[model samples]
Target: MKIKKAFRRVGMFSLFVAAFLVTITSISNVSFADVRDWVDYEPMRITNTVTNTVTESKFRQSSLEKKELNYLEQKKMYISSDEIEGPKTLEEAANINQYPKSQVVATGYTAGVESTGKSPGHPEYGITYSGVQVKRDLYSTIAADLDVYPIGTILFIPDYGYGVVADKGSAITGNKIDLFFNTVEDVYAQWGKKELDVHLIELGDGTLTEKELKQLNETDSLQVFRQQITES
Candidate 1:
C-alpha cells in the first residue's frame, strides 16, 4: 500500500509539471503583434516627427471608459458661472492658411444627442459629415471648418495623433475645432477647450460646394449631421 501511494504521488507530480510546461509554452508562442492592439492604448512618446512639438502623445480620450459620475454633480455645483464662456470664441471669423501647420482651439465631444442630437442606434450615430464612421483611440476623428480644411483634410494635433476632418460645426468656423470623445464628461475633463498645435499633413478636395482655405478646415461628422445639438 505504501509503494502504491508513493507511485500515485509521483504520477500526480509529473502531471502538474507537464501542465506547467504547456502553459509557459503557450504564453511564449503568443506573438507580440497578437497583443499589440491592446498594448498600444498607452500613449506613445517619441521624437523626430511633427505630431507634437513637445514630443508627447495623449492617450486617446477613450470612449470605452466607464466610471462613476455621481461625484461630478458636486464638482459642477461649485463651478463659478463667471468662468464659463460660450462655446464659440469671441474672435472674428476669418479664413487662414492652415496648410502644413497652425494653432487651433480644440474642444472634445462625444457622440450623443447632447452633442449631436442623435442618440445611439440612430441611423447616423457615429457617422461623420464626410459619411465615414468615427472611431476612438487611433481612429479618432475631428470636426473643423470645411471651408478651410475641406472634406478630407488630414491633421496631426499635439498629444493627439493623426485625425481626419470628418465633420464640421457652426461654432467650429475659423481657427476653432471640435474633437470627438466618448462622453460629454470627457469633453470637460480630458480636453476642455484650448489652443493647441496642429500639423496639417494634407488638404482634402473641396466637395460639391466650396473651399476658400485655412485653420479649422476639417468638418466634424456629428456637427455636419446634427444641426440642432448645440445649446443657446
Candidate 2:
C-alpha cells in the first residue's frame, strides 16, 4: 500500500514539473514576441543635406485657375511676358525681386563628394578635385530656419530629383541651391550658368531610416571611417 502511494505521489510531481516547464516556455515565447514587434515598429529618421544657393527663374508663369469666354475668332487671351533677368551671385539672390510673394529662405551646402579627398572626372581638366562634386545627397541643403525646418528634414527638388540632408557643410550658407554633378566633365557639359526653376518640397527631418542606415554600412564614407578607426 505504501509503495503504491509513493508511486502516485511521484507521478503527480512529474506532471507538476512538466506543467511548470511548459508555462516557462510559453512566457519566454511571449516575451520574445513582444520584442520582435517593437523592433518591427521602430520609427524612421531621415535627414537631408544640401548646398547654400537657390536659383529662381522668373521665366516661370502661374497658370490661371479658370479662363472665361474662349473666343475662337479673337485668337484667345494669354499674357506672355518677358523673362525677368536677375542676379546670380549669393549677395544678389536674397532679394525677392521676381517672385514678390515668394519668401527667401537660406539653405546651406554647395556640393558633396564621397569624402573630403579624391578627384572626380572633369572633361576639360581631366580627373580633378578643385571644384566640389557631390556624389551623394546633392540637391537639398540644410535650411537656415532650423526652427521651421528642423534637422533630419527631407527636401524634394524636382529639378534635382530627391536628396537627403544628412550633414551640413561649412561653405553652404544662405538662400542657395547647389547642383551636384558626378564628374567635372558633366558640370562643363551643361555649359555656362543655365537658368533653372527648381521645385522644393520638404521631406521629413532627413533622419536615417533603417534602410538608409544599411546603405551607410556599405558606402565609401564608412570605409574612410574604418581606416580612421584603425589609425586612431
Candidate 3:
C-alpha cells in the first residue's frame, strides 16, 4: 500500500512541473510577437517622416522660383516705349536740338594704340589730347574736335548708343569723331570711317534748368535719357 502511495505523489509532481514549463513558454512567445510587430512598424513610420520632409522642401523651392519669375516680368513692363522707337514729333526734334553746336553728322575713328607716350588723362598710352580720361566702354567715350563738340558734351548716336566727349584728336577735327578702343585689333575690326547721326544731349557744364528738367521728366521719349543723366 505505501509503494502505491509514493508512485501517485511522484506522478502529481511531474504533471505540475510540465504545466509550469508550458506557462513559461507561452509568456515568452507573447513577448517575442510584440517585439516583432514593433520592429516591422518602426521602418514604415521612419519612411513616412522622410517622405513628408522631402515634400515640404520641394513645395518651398517651387514657391521661390515662381516669386522670382513674377519679379522679372514686372521689371520688363517698366521698359519705356521710346527705347523701342526713335524721336517722333517736331517738338521732340526741337527739344533734342538744345545743344545745336554740339550735334553733327560725323565719321568715327579709334584711338588707344595710336597714342604716344604720357597722354594727359590716360598716362598709360597718352592717347587723349583733352587731358580727360577716356572710359573703357566701347560706346561711352569719344574723342572730338573741341571747337565742334566741347569737353563734357554728351552725344547720342543712332547705331552706336550714347557717349561723352572726353578727349580730342588732331585728325578728329571738323565733323569727325574718334571712338576709343582698348585694343588696336578691336579698333580696326569694329569701326572705321562710317557716317554717324550724332545728337548733342548736353553741352559744356551740362546743367539742367528747373523748367528743362520738368519738361524732360514729363516726356516719355526722354525717360531713359533723364534716368541716365540723373544717375550719373
Candidate 4:
C-alpha cells in the first residue's frame, strides 16, 4: 500500500511538470508571432529637385477705413475691403532677371510663384515662372503625408509642380500636402491642389562621387541617395 501511494504521487508530479512546461512554450510562441512583423524595416533616402520663381505685382487700394459703417449696419462696424482693379506694385510685372530682396509671407509653410492671367491684357491666362518677384516671403511645407518619411524633413523646392518637405507644418500633419500657387487662377486651374503619392530618392550616400552632385546641379535637377552596396 505504501509503495502504491508513493507511485501515485510521483505520477501526478510528473504530469504537472509537463503541463507547466507546455504552457510556457505556448506563451513564448505567441509572443514571437506577435512581433514577427516588426523586424528589419530599413530606412530609405530620397531627394527631388524643384525649380521655383516668384512674381510680385501691386494691387489697388479701396477708399475704405477700418471701423467704418456699412450700408445697412445700425451701428459703427469694422470694415475691410479687397484692393482690386490694379496691380500690387508699380514696378515691372515680370522681373525674372533681377534679384531683389523678397518679402516674407508665411514662414514654416510652402509657397510658389505663378501667373494670374488677370494682367490687363489677358484676363484669363497664366503660367508658373522659374523666377519672379513677390511682396511676401514664400514658405515650403512638409509634414506626415508620405508613409516613408517623418515630419520636419527639410526639402528644397524650386518652382511649380515640384516640392519636398524642407520643414513640416501643423496643418500638414498627415498624408496631406499643401502646394503654393502664385495666383488664384492657377489655384483654380486644377480645381484646387490634388493629392498624389510620390517616390523620394535618397541623397547623401558616400558612394556617390562629388562629380555626381555637380552634374545634377548643372542639369538643374536635384540628387537623391541610395543605400551602400557591399563590394564582395
lDDT of 3 at 46: 26
- 1-232, model 2: which lDDT tens digit per residue? 9999999999999999989866765654434344454455433333434655445432211111122333336566665554344433321332323322222333222232432233345342212122212233322222233333344444443323334444443443444333344444544553223334433344345244434534533565234333322222
In TM-score terms, candidate 2 sits at 0.28
Q: What are the models' TM-scores?
A: 0.45, 0.28, 0.40, 0.24
Clash tally, candidates in order: 14, 34, 1, 38
RMSD of 2: 33.1
Return whichever of 3 and 4 wins on lDDT. Answer: 3
Local distance difference test scores for all models? 0.63, 0.38, 0.54, 0.33
Model 1 whole-model lDDT (C-alpha atoms): 0.63
Show model 3 residue runs off by greater than 4 Å.
Answer: 1-111, 115-127, 206-232
Better of 2 and 3 by TM-score: 3
Candidate number with the higher TM-score (1 or 3): 1
Residue-by-residue lDDT tens digits, candidate 4, 127-224 = 11222121111222233333423432322322321232322334444445445434455446532554333333232221222243234333421211
Query: Model 2: runs farther than 4 Å from truth?
Result: 1-152, 191-197, 213-232
lDDT of 4 at 210: 28
lDDT score at residue 42, model 4, on the 0-100 scale: 29
